[model samples]
Target: MKTIHKKNTTFLNLAAAALMVAALVLGCKPNVSNGGEVQPPVTDGCTITMSAGANGSITASPVIPAGGKVAKGAEITFTATANPGYRVDTWMVTPTKALTADGQQGDAIAKVKVTANTTVNVTFKPIVYTPVAYADLHNHLTTAQPETNGIYYIEITGLTAPDVTGNSIRDSASPLGQILNSNRQKKVALKFGAIAGVTDMSSCFNGCTSLVQVSDIPNSVTDMYSCFKGCTKLEHVPNIPNSVTDMHSCFYGCTKLEHVPNIPDGVTDMYSCFEDCTSLTSVTLKCEYLDGKFHYAFYDCSRLSTGSIKVPADSLDDYKDNADKMKAEAEWFAKDE
Candidate 1:
């Protein structure tokens, strides 16, 4: 037939060229050129960081966005760093317009606004603490006897004696006989081992007009009437501690004693002693018993006629007949010496 029909058309054109080379070796092989340019795939948002256990650490960025939608006011900002010695005293932001910066030198920065998912709080404080000192004089008859007003300064360093029955200090029952009739203490210092077991210091610094000072006097004190009655700034009268006997009214109104000490011979009774001192200038007596007859004992001593009056020349006729008013005050202080 025509060569078998042209061999079936050359076997159908070699099966159509072997199906187009097997579809070009399985779809066009090598076309590789990966020189970059492909990106696009990374989405992560919401982030915040801050920490401090001993002090230091803070950060905030990406607090939610990238399509996660949290933007109701978006404005977050935060930064803080300070470790070593730790110092960043203040920086705050906690719900309410948030905005702060102060401390850590400069740049502690802070700003807030993501309205919904919010939480901010920060605080720090420390500076100094240490100091103390005390001296509280007899602590107001022991622990401020129920504190009434206030006015205290204590420095009575070791009182010599006299605590009679003030309970040694406890609401004072006799605290030195009620501080010898206190007027709210203006100044007092009976310091240096305050004579103890006082016998009878009559009136004991009577109306102490803020006694200036009356140091050590305790030879086992015996008796001395009205001892310094209305002491209006007594000038001097310290030595008399020979275990005295009796010298009544001893310096009644020491208007400002000038001098009067040598009256030691176991005094019997010079009653009304120096009644109204009025600034007596002199007096020396070795008492052998004036027999208490100087009635008003130099009544208004008016400066004792201006000084000098020693007794004991053998009791000068029993002190001029039982001291006729102290022999007219020792002949008016021997006619003014």
Candidate 2:
């Protein structure tokens, strides 16, 4: 009986030794209770770290705790937000955690499954606007409203000139017209960028009652028919392109226009070009009227009396010969060279 009890004790000792070896292999230790019974090993929670790159901020849903520790199988959500002129670029996860809800680069939301400690990072990039190619660049702002100060600020680049098919900026559907018709007393400031390859600008600013200034017209333009007509408050104008051949009713009803550039010699049509320009003081005629008449070109110019108009000395007789056709007093422009 004593030999049998000794054998039982030896078997219990071998079992305890095997349990210790197995615990070492599994990266855990057996815990002994007060009753000397072995208990399972305990595990600590994992950690998650998040960071945001420049020009943006990152946040997590359900809020990481104060210690940034989470359960081994918790699902964490991350969202990235970009500042103005910026956008989310990419996301990176360290140690290759399981992503249950993955998103491509530039997407703002993602979900990650944390099986181990991991670090999440997000990067941002700036937004760049590419220049549009030259073509019709009009009427895009037709429905845009002005700021509180009653001014429309606009910027456009690569604008090719429009043909005579009523595609000009002064057409009925034009934004410039909308801006003025919304409040005819307000002013508009416009800026142009890189204008090229343009040949026509007919009725470009017609009926813009509050326009007070304009940028230089490109020299490639050849037409100015009714271009600045009905700009009642415009006080100054850029030089007319030397390539222009038409000025039909170009400055009609310009109540505040104060000066006129020398008419280009290429002009072939000047009919009523300055009619009803109530504030025009003087003008010089360089166009010789070779084939076209200037009938009523200066009609109803209340501020332009006799001698207010000037003609080149070389063209005075030619102008005088056509004075009846021009509807101007022949003596009004014959003295000045």
Candidate 3:
């Protein structure tokens, strides 16, 4: 409680300051580097740098992205996506090593190991491809007839999908309908281009009795009258494009087709659409309405379960009671019955 002398107090304060300095020096010594400078957090990792080859970007996985770091021995993948009109031509990796590559051109991707600091260089080039054009092999001038063997054969080998949507160029305007049949010569393969500008598919394959296979059709089609009426051997029918509105007798006599794809809401006329599809078991006609025009649409779909008409579950009664009620009744009869 008594006042302390200044000389004695100064000596005690100096000793306290010495202890504090010693504790700090011990706590911080481990973090000092050889230069006596505080070091950054240490890490055992490598850097991976990716840049555009030509108007495109290179994406990677398991690599420190965006000027970052990844652990050594990590497996990394770099994928190239070329911009429009450009394609990936080559890759240049600094400190080069063997790389496992996959995919083609503009969509190429490669895998490599992270051993050292690396730089990825990709080169891109202009893409070149043949302008696709389709020619109708059968129509009014060349009715859907078969070869001397009485069978039609279609081989679509090198065709690829088009970039445009809902457009097609029809090879023939007045196609007779059944020319797609497989003539004992070979299977009918239509891997051809998507006929985008085409709008009419009426009677496209109507009487193809031996037509067992049909490729995907263009989504630009609108008319489909009597398209597959007599494709008796076709077991499975692909979905027609949603652009179709005129469905008059589209599948009238396709005796072996088992199901009908979803009918789009745009459809207004379904006159005799499935009149004679004898083996038909189901249909997806969620299209809320069918004004009397489809009365005989299912006339011969005898095998179709009453429940097979897959409408919105809430509107089953409405379909049977209102939309084309006559068709609901005609669903019982088959060809010649």
Candidate 4:
């Protein structure tokens, strides 16, 4: 081999020595920084994004750090809330994160400790159910007759949740006769709702001496001949249905009745709707069709004076005597004040 040049050898030696010195300085560096232990190299953390389905929201505890970024070992609780008419269906976690609560894989609440990037999707579903509605119908009297005395009760079908405006309902034409003729019982409990099919109520509660209540007059009735002829203890008559055409002797002897319902404009015959109502002081006969007849409609109402009827008496000039009988025994009609 050719002999090496002196300058080249010297330069090589210098370079080798310089590299060794640099390595020593770097390896001997202090393990401290600003009086604190040195920290590991910085690395990116995991990311978590939540997706809530329609009409629902996800609430988290220890908030999944801002922007869905969290430490490697951080734990987060995700709760799903659904609005009215909805229920929680599932909490779908991506990559199958660690769940603290035991339940089906995709349903129920989840407490997750993230190991990597995660995504939780909340899926809500509409609750499914079916509802049923119906009614009961019974025939003949069911309640046992009173052990003693005059106590009677009757049930009316379609009374529960009835259509009040309905007028075709069917019921007993002579409910009182059926009850009294059997036992001659006195006390009566007339439970009823809207009258939808009843067409007659003649003598329905006639001669109920001990009947304290004359249940409301039916709206489906066309007749009321002596319906409450002798309900002496009845304190009130709620209303007279607009469908009634005849109200002869309807409240003929309700002596204790102080109030009478307004006579519907449809009534064509009021022979004695409120006859002998001695306690009544005022009356209204607003029927516009009443031209000349209502014979003794309020006859013997001793407390109601002549002219006490509230009809357009001038329009009934020919039957003033009948109109007079419509008022209390001597009471006069009430003129417009």
Candidate 5:
């Protein structure tokens, strides 16, 4: 009985040892080989790059592969950078209707199948031209008649001296005076004395047939001759200046001139001053030099039938002597009456 018990114990120990060896062998076995080969990580394809220039330039790289398959509902991106002074104008992508970086128009992208590799580029630049300026009346006002036929009352305020040579305020042959002679020109309002050294009204107002009225006369004027001659429509005249030394035919042939203002104290000569003013009724000669020899001065003023003329009381004798000649010249209006 003792021997049998010992043998059973031995068998139990052997079974336990076999179970331990089996467990160790299974635990020590390798699951993989030791060749040291590395596996590559999966990546979705897209790239970006840049170029530069003197003014500016743009560059892009490794475009979307043509028809290259991408998983459905997958997102893809492309990006670029620009140099100094240049601004990105636009961007675009093509083929498969997959996804886009920024909202841009062109081909849409969904699931991409890149049959051929593609590339794209964007461009940039700066600004260019500008403008200039000019003088105001460089070609506006002139002596020539208005191109369109219409009466224009021109006030030459700032223009006292003509820009061209031989054209001064006192000269009749001036460019401004020539403009006044244009028969097509209806009326003009001349404002003098804006410039210096002008002192006469000779041919300035001569041959201006359309002149109806003249307002301010430059006090600087010293001579007054044919200034008011051909101004047949002039009904009223402002007072002559005291600086005037000559009054030769000043108001001659101004047939419509009905009224005359008082002459300034400095006037000396009155040669044919009121010769053809047939509408003048009363004469006021306040001068001391009204001699009977000053004949034909008020010659053809035929409208003086009943109106009294006031000459220097001392010069009444001189006027009474020349009354016959005055009556002879005034016979035209008398016959009309």
Candidate 6:
């Protein structure tokens, strides 16, 4: 019995040796311990690191814990969201390997494979904005007029947000032709984004009789000729910039406007500026009196009595004399406090 067991053990040992020789000849290599025992590669606790660059934030799906460790070959999905006025610029994958939807379309979401220790980085950058020209807006709206937030608005296709630069409307050749004058019957409430370099605003909103509210006048605008003429429903007047020189017929038919801000000193033309403003009661002038320019400036403002026009204290007598000559008896010039 003992001799038979010995033979069986020797046969098993010989068979193992033969198998090892065959494996070596076939170029098959397996990890072996110093004790001559075969072992498999360890795959536990593999990790994927992720980070978000400036102007954005990142999140992982299936909820990687604080340690961020996972089993090898586990799939993780990442979603990057940009801050306001910004967009994802690029996605960086360290030790690049097989990935799914990896930003080829600038998509914010991507799937990552945890092969070895892997790193996924997402970078965000401020979106470069292109200007919207008058012609560009005109072309888009000619076929269809779109409205947003109660405003007849148009945005450039690629821009992430709206930014009105001065160069946008600098090429406008027509100022007195009522650039944005729309049908008087439709109610319009204008809310302007920042406008930097406009100098001529003549008749820009002219004939927009239904215009009720307007905000943000460009500080660089100098000519406001008939800018809001015939806007009978307009009640609030945006502060006029000091760069203006011509306000001829600026608010000629704004019947609902009751108060006027200090008229800038650079104005040289006020002809019919506030004509037919029947509801107007107060006006403050900062500009020096110009002969004949004040004529008909407040022609039909019945509520604007002679004492209601406030003039600079230093120039009160001269403005009064000019007002008398200009036949603005009902809008008599008074010293401003």
Top-scoring candidate (lDDT): 2
Candidate 4: worst-modelled 10 consecutive residues by lDDT: 129-138
lDDT of 3 by residue, 232-263 (tens): 77654556788888888778888877656677
Candidate 1, which segments miss by more than 4 Å at Cα? 1-158, 161-207, 210-219, 222-242, 245-249, 254-265, 268-272, 277-296, 301-337
In candidate 1, what are the lDDT values of residues 1-337, reduced to their tens digit?
9999999999999999999989887555444346743433323332323344346666555443444444555666655544432324555454444443332222344666654435554443321111111233434434443111121222344443444323311322234535535543444324324445667665556556555335445677776666656666655455677678766766667676656667787877667777777757677777664454446666777665522666666765555455456534545432211
On residues 112-154, what C-alpha lDDT tens digit does candidate 4 reach at each position? Answer: 8878778877877653322111122112323444312133334
Q: Write the per-residue lDDT of candidate 5 for residues 5-56, one digit (tens) a residue.
A: 9999999999999999999986665543457434332245433222232343
Model 6 stretches astray by more than 4 angstroms: 1-180
Cα misplacement distance, residue 99 of candidate 3 (Å): 51
Which model, 2 or 3, shows the larger lDDT?
Answer: 2
Report the CA-based lDDT of candidate 6 relative to the real structure: 0.67
lDDT of 2 by residue, 1-337 (tens): 9999999999999999999999887555466687976665537677899999999999887688988888888888898866645557888887664667764576667798888878999998864432322232233334455443344444455454442213344344134344444556566544455556766667777787767555457788787877778888776576787899988888888987867777887888899898888878788777776535588787777776777877767778877777667666676675455
lDDT, candidates in the order shown? 0.52, 0.69, 0.60, 0.59, 0.50, 0.67
Q: TM-score per candidate, in order?
A: 0.23, 0.50, 0.46, 0.44, 0.46, 0.48
Candidates sorted on TM-score, descending: 2, 6, 5, 3, 4, 1
Candidate 5, residue 160: lDDT:
52
Write down the RMSD of all candidates, one decimal each: 35.6, 24.5, 16.1, 25.5, 36.6, 20.5
Q: Please provide, for model 6 over 207-297, each residue's C-alpha lDDT reduced to its tens digit, 9 standing for 90 to 100.
A: 6665655544778888888777777877666688999998888888898887777899889999889899887878888887788787788
